[model samples]
Target: MHSRKIYTNTKAIAWVTIGTALFSLIFASGKFADGSASPLQILFLRYIGGLATLLLVVLVRRERLSAYRSPKPLSHFIRAVFGASGGGALIYASANMPIVDATALGLLYVVFVIPLGVLVLKEQLSSQHFGAIAICCAGAAIVMASRGAFTEFHMAYVFPAGIAVLGAALLAVEGLMIKMLSHSDRTMTVLLYVNAFGILLMAGPAAMQWVPLSFESAISFILLGPIAVTAQYCIVQGYRLASLSIVGPVDYTWLIFAGLIGFMFFGEKPTLGVAAGSAIIAIGGIMLAIIKPPAGEHESTSSA
Candidate 1:
């Protein structure tokens, strides 16, 4: 039993690392697409591609169609809205902001989840959590202030950072919604509805900017859908195989990978402030992960 536990944990760590890399790659792809497509267009193609791929997976696996049914359509729709809006905002930010900065701001989702979880899940927060929140808030402010100073207050630099913060908040809300929905819905059911509503929500803007896709763009879009869906699955699998405290921190590796990709592929670099703020934010997050919640508080529930 001890050996089995060790193996499971090792597998979880590995899967979580892979999942983080995939998520970073997804952000990179969004950055790439930004040059050739608007966020709306990317959203439409991504969801359409994801929906189609998911449907194919279901069909090929002979999964029961009924498994897609959700008891709470309205709640799922809310999730869909949050998911699509957050995704669009992140992609826009990813395109406009330095990749490392974008990735750092996105990490605020973990911090935002603290307040969101309290409000939405009625989860209790301890003094330590409040302390973490304060630190996180300071870190965010520092990052923003640093960016503004570095850019000499350029809107071109500041706007996307602001949007990235907004996206992080939206993603936190989406995470809470997912927790609620998970109580009554299957994972696939939740995902299907997210993409379904995403298609509907993004279709209008996507159509307005409609242009024929080249073969390369078409292939990229097709692959993007499955890649994102697969990353989500890998995350789920990692969490399933290990404790949240063990695996959750691994998600932050996205920032490192994003920085590497940005520098190597996009000629972007991180500033000192970016590094400091990221460190502070990461420290707070790691504390949140390591500190045990009060007993009888459903601490087993994942934060996002």
Candidate 2:
């Protein structure tokens, strides 16, 4: 039983890791599209891409339109709003600031997840795990603050940084919504609604900032659909496979993925503060993953 549990967790972690790595690419793409497209435009194209891919899959599989129906339409709408706004905020923030810092701010969602997990999902895990989460958030804040030194003297950058924080909180709420919706809807169904709503919510804003894309840029924008869909799919699957307490910490991997991509592709590098912060985060994550509950108590683990 123990071995089987380990395998299940390992698999869940693997899926989520791939999803987050791919998610980092989305962040990078936001930066890549910065000068070429507004955040709304990018979000619109991304949702269109995701919706298109999902439609193709449904057609290819001969899926019934009924597969898209959900008992919780309002829930789906609310989640979509949160997801779209949160995503749009991140895209804008990513464009204005370093992708790594934006990514770090996004990582703050995991911090909010613990409390929400307890309140909404009723998740029970080790106190150590909760502390570990705090550690990771502190570290991410340090990383963000360190990179923030680049703008330490620049006052214009402050608002975008604040937007990033808002985005993270919204996303944390969206994550819990996903958990709630998963109880009543299929993953594909949930995704279909979110993407469809994403398009609708972003349409007006996107149209306001519309610009014709070059051939190369058009191709890249279209590709955003598949990447976003797949990444979201994996993340949803991870939640289905493990408790949020387990999956939330792993979400911190976004910083590592973002930092590397920022350095390799954007010629950005982290300062010493980033290194120190990341080390603390690493310690916390390790503790979260490996530590056991005290005697006679086990974590409240659930599959969904």
Candidate 3:
């Protein structure tokens, strides 16, 4: 049992590292896309690339699409809607904001997921979790305040912020669904459905806004899709090997990487307030992750 636990912890760290790196790549790619493409065009390319990569994986594993035959097609559809919306929001934000700022806001999904778990999944919430949420909110506020993100009131800022909130909600729902499906479905299958359905669903809106893609933009789009896929896969693997609370907080490490990448590539620097707030948020998340709720206590609240 001790050996197993140690192995699980190692896997968790690996997942966190891999997941963070891929996400960082995704953010960096988004920054790249912003320079040359529209959000819709980027979304279309991402999905197309994701779909192609998934198809190749399926073929290599000889996994039949029939294997993904789900009785809950509606659930898959819902997941797709949330996933697509989240993607659109992130891409939109990346186009307008500095990559780090966009990523910082996007990380709010961690805060959003906690309440979602409590209310939707009927999980219990502890005081520690509440404290964690509070900390994360404070952090988010700090980042926003430091960046003067609220003062501008421009579409670029406003739109992505809205999307970030929406994305967090969607991701919370996705977590519940994943937990439910974990009983019978493999993570790959769940991921595959989400990606495939997301591509199909987003294609309509994306097509409406479509512009012709250049060779450079096409490559970035393709790469973005695969990076996202790989990140999700790594996350799933991490979850499979350990408890959610253990692996979840490590995901927040993305902010650090985002900050670094933003500085290195875009010459964007976070202000003291943003840095301090991000630290608070990271601490709160870490506290929550390491805390084991009392037996029979839920880890979220109804208002989450």
Candidate 4:
């Protein structure tokens, strides 16, 4: 009984950590957005920060870089390209739009993944999945339309929304790749390579549009990587102690956190429409989470 209770508690912590990390991501992105940093510059700082954290880990563990090898070099390259593209789009979107709005738009990826899985990865979608997708999309539409009432529609919204879809698709691909590679690769090895390649790919473009950083911006940029790493570690450790199903819904806490931070930091107020739409989106996401795919049905690569 004690062990079970401990396990439950750990899982709770893990979910909280995941949600908190996501919340941190919103704030970090918002900071970049408010600064009006170029998309390339934002990407550069994010990748550099992430890479530096991984390098520090490598050093502390005394792990040799050569120890990490990919069985599918081409796949890694492709994944990196897709990942970088998504990152670039996100940076652009985040910088130009409200943080909560960007996040809401990004959530549409969950809806896109449903169809992409069936078409691209040949995964079967059950009726429940379809229903969930429909519900989620409805919620997303509500959110998007709500935004239109307050602000004039711009081409920029399309960019972020499109990137969100692409990012979701890329993430789905990455998951499949990870599963295939896990046959021979350690998790850390795959992560290291992904980050390394991602950094290399973004560096040149980011440098082309670089801006001088204020002392505060420099500090924020530097801290971003370490915070992300710590948050990820906490999440991993938390999962080890708890059931995923129980912890999964807790991840939505980031939305609340994002809303709060967005309002406080940026003075972005949530209108009734935004609130109603967000609630619907949240409900759809939760439904998707709770509903299971049917037996004998292969889950799609894009479902994540």
Candidate 5:
């Protein structure tokens, strides 16, 4: 049993690592599409792709449509709203900011989770968690403040930076909602609803922003959904295979993968402040991941 548990955890870490890398690729694809598509357009394509992929999964598994129904439809709707908003913001930043910086900043969701856990999940708050949150916030500020020194201090950068931070907060809310939804909803059910609602909400803006895309860009846009869906499944499986304390830090590998990809593909380099800030934030995130809540306290371990 002990060896089996170890093997399972090792497999989980591998899956999470792959998932994180794929997530970086997904963001990179968004960055690539930035020139040819609007954020809404990218979001719409992602939603369409994700919805299609989930539908296929449901069909292949011979799962009834009703199996996707959630007891908490309202919670799913709220989760979808936040998920779409956060996703839109993330893609916006991907388009406007360096992939490494945007990816690092995106990790701030882990920081936001602490306070949100307290307020929304009713989880106990400890001094250590508060200290970690403070560190994380400071790191985020440093990353944003350092942006001007490396890049131009223009609204172009400012707007996306603000949106990225907001995206992190919104995603934090989604995490809380997912915690609640997990009790009664299957993973696929929650995902199916979120994508369905996202598609519905984004259709109007996506239609308005629609521009003719080259074959290559269109293919890239279509690919986002499969990539995203696969990544989400990998993350979910990873978490299911192992405890958060074991696999959580592996999720941070996304930033590293982003940094490597940005350098190779976009010739992007992080400034000293960006590097320092990201390190600080990573430290805090790892600390939070290792924290063990008191028995019976509802801690969020969802990687999605």
Candidate 6:
């Protein structure tokens, strides 16, 4: 029993980590598609890609079409609304701002998730988890402030940065909804519905603004599908296997990954602040992996 709990917790951390890295790239890739397409168009293409990948997975498994049906249709709808809009906002902000700054701002959702989870889902926030999250947030503060890493805030970016915050808040609501869905839905079912609904939601807006894409931008958006499938699948499974408070801060890793990827692909330079802050963030991530949530309830629910 002890071993089983450890296994699920371990798997949860792995899923969130891998998914977050891939998701960072998905957002970073938004930078390429910016001018070539509107945020809606980019997001639409990405969803189309995600749904396509999911269907292929279904085909490979030879799963019945029925496997996609979920019991929580309204729940999924709310999640989709949040997912589509929040995602579009993030892409819009990412397209407009430096990738690291946009992402760090977007992570404001994780901070909100704890209280939101408590109020909405009645999830416990362990002291250990809260402390780790604080550490991560402190690191995030440094990342967002560092001249070498984050772009200095200017009134010029006020709109998109504000949009980024709105996006984070919406995604936080979406996270609570996902926690409810994860109680019963299969990971693929969770993602399939989100992509299906998200695609439907974006199609009209995206169509209105569709524009010709460069070869590079075209490939980048096309790749969003597989990345979406891989990342969302891992994340759903992680959520299924762990508590919200425990797994939510694991998202801090995305900020770190975004910083590095932004440096390589977007020419952002890193300095001592970036190095030091990231290390502190890494410590928090380690805390998440090692710290157990209150044992009994987690194990009780997890064994199912």
Best by lDDT: 6
Ranking by lDDT: 6, 2, 5, 1, 3, 4
Name the regions of candidate 2 deviating beyond 4 angstroms: 91-105, 149-162, 269-283, 291-304
User: Residue 136's C-alpha lDDT in candidate 1?
Assistant: 53
- Cand. 3 TM to true fold: 0.76
**Order of quality (TM-score):** 6, 2, 3, 1, 5, 4
Instruction: Report the Cα lDDT for residue 136, model 5.
Output: 59
What is the C-alpha lDDT profile of model 6 across 191-241, one tens digit per residue? 889999988999898888889888777667867889878998788778777
What C-alpha root-mean-square deviation, in Å, does candidate 4 show against the real structure? Answer: 6.3
Model 6 lowest lDDT segment of ten? 295-304
| C-alpha local distance difference test of each model | 0.68, 0.77, 0.66, 0.56, 0.69, 0.79
Which sections of candidate 4 miss by over 4 Å?
Answer: 1-33, 90-108, 149-184, 229-257, 297-304
Model with the higher TM-score, candidate 3 or 4: 3
lDDT value, residue 136 of candidate 4: 49
User: Which 10 residues in a row give candidate 1 its minimum summed lDDT?
Assistant: 295-304
Tens-digit per-residue lDDT, 1-304, candidate 2: 4455455656666778889899889867757876787667877888889999999988998978687788888889999888888977887887797765676677778878768987887776777777877787788778777776345435776899899989999999998887677656777888899999888898998999999889889778878999999998888887776667777877877777777887888888867887888788677666655545334432223322
Compute the lDDT for candidate 4. Answer: 0.56
TM-score of each: 0.73, 0.84, 0.76, 0.68, 0.72, 0.87
Candidate with maximal TM-score:
6
lDDT tens string, model 5, 97-125? 77445655677776675566567646665
Candidate with more favorable, higher lDDT: 2 or 6 = 6
**Compared with the true structure, what per-residue lDDT tens digits does model 4 show for residues 1-304?**
4444544544444445464655467355646466556556665676667778887777888978776666777777776787677656655666666644666555544444345445654655567556655654665566556656225446767766666556655654543444344334555555566667877897898788877878777667656666555554454343333323223333444554555565777787967766775677566555544554344533211100
Candidate 5 structure, TM-score to reference: 0.72
